[model samples]
Target: MAEKLLEVRDLVTAFDTEQGRLRAVDGVTFEVEEGKTLGIVGESGCGKSVTALSIMQLLPRPMGHIDGGSILFKARDLVVASADVMHDVRGDEIGMIFQEPMTALNPVQRIGRQVSEVFLLHKEMDKTEAWASSIDVLEKVGIPSPEIRMSEYPHQLSGGMRQRVMIGMALACKPDLLIADEPTTALDVTVQAQILKLIADLQKEMGMSVILITHDLGVIAETCDEVVVMYAGRVVERAPVLELFGNPLHAYTRGLLQSIPRLDRERKTRLPTIEGNVPSLEEMPEGCRFSTRAPEAHDEAAIRERPPFEEAAPGHWVEACRFCYAG
Candidate 1:
């Protein structure tokens, strides 16, 4: 087996809401092997992005915090790493492609300066050298007219171009792991395809592990080696990408798979849905968080206690609900 690059075990992240401390990411766990991609898939608000933010230790502080658990990266745990240690880790050892580049990029800064800052901060390059290297990275990411684009401000560029710039910044330091949070969000279909391909190509070229957090199963199918299905802040099922697509085990996984639109004449019906919404962080139910929405959740144990994840098949895991579910 390839060495583990990132392992998140029993991660618990919470938000200090007015009502109380609400767990946004509840005991989510997954791992990324070196030079591989792990996809985190779920509906919006299912803790997909929260899980990524927790790994990066980029949670909105005071309001948001990692409450417990370990985030091991390259044999070192990040949950306990000092601020200075994490400062070195963020861009040098781990890079992140945040969603919505328009908001994430600085409107006031010229594109070149923003991208070059990574080199100046992490690589100890001088301003002149950093500018030259940033332009090279911009070109590497397929930005047309890198020199001209470097002078442009965020507001002056197209959305796709801005996104490519974001990619340039994220990869400038050649971080060992990249966390992409909804990298294809809000783009045209053509642009989305391009972005996904670009990310895949780069990961392969750099031999970097990746954590792709998205609700799009299609994206996950195309990009990830392993798949993690999350519901209400927990990993309900996890397996190799092919195993997940071929035989999803958890009820939520089945519902998500069923909801994907298809062209078959036999699929001419309203898409399947899980019926109930994911519970709010402030008001989660007792027992299995998914029992509120799972069709197979009928036994008292599903409501009285949470299901443990156990191997249902080789290299495939599912919440051990079948043992307790009455129906």
Candidate 2:
């Protein structure tokens, strides 16, 4: 069996709003295996990013917190870990690439300072050593003219270059796991492909596990070994990539797959879509959250009580509601 690097069990992340305490990640459970990629797929407001932030302990202070659950990294529970422990773990043991590089990067800092900070903080390297290491990382991530780019600010580089810098920072310490939360968002198709390929190449070179959170199934199909399908703060289904794509059991998963535009289809044919927006936290359903939007008729009991997430096949788990479970 593969070694488990990270195990998140019953993760419940919440925010205290005027409306009251609202759970954004409700009972989310998944694991990342050593040197493998796990993709978390869901629409906006489905708690994908919140789950990532919860793991990193980077949630908005005062309002957001992990209300319940255990995030275990290398057998260590992060939920109860001290601030100092988490600080050590953030970039040294686990690194993260945020969705947007423009917003994530320090606007005023030069590229060298930002990238070298990772080594300075985690590796305890001096200014000269850290600067040299940062340039090496920038070069490794395919940043052209790294020596010159190091002196430039975030606004000086192109979108793809900025993203490459972000990748360099994340991988500076060669962490055991890398959490990329839509690392290619807002980039052109060509740049998106390049960024994904760069990440795959680096993962292979570094031998690190990755938790890739994105709504793009295509990216998941290309890069992920296992897949977790989330809807309304809960994981609706999970399976190996081939298993999930070939034999999707949950209604929500099926809907998402069907919505992907097919090249084999007739020209101008309308692409299918999952109808209805994700329900607001205040209006979230008490039971199987996807049941409200599920097209087929379902048992009323599903609405009254949450259905058990059960394995329908080897390595394939689904929210086992009568109507929701296709198998």
| Best candidate (score: lDDT) | 2
Model 2 / residue 294 / CA error / Å: 0.7
Error of 1 at 97 (Å): 0.7
| Candidate 2 Cα outliers beyond 4 Å, as residue runs | none
- lDDT for position 169 in model 1: 88
**lDDT accuracy of residue 138 in candidate 2:** 93
Error of 1 at 275 (Å): 1.6
**Per-residue lDDT of 248-320 in model 2, one digit per residue for the tens?**
9988999999999888888586888888889899998788788778897666787778889898998889988
**Stretches > 4 Å off in candidate 1:** 323-327
Best by TM-score: 2
CA lDDT for candidate 2:
0.92
Model 2, position 246, has a per-residue lDDT of: 99
TM-score for each model: 0.96, 0.98
Q: How far is candidate 2 from the true structure (C-alpha RMSD, Å)?
A: 1.0
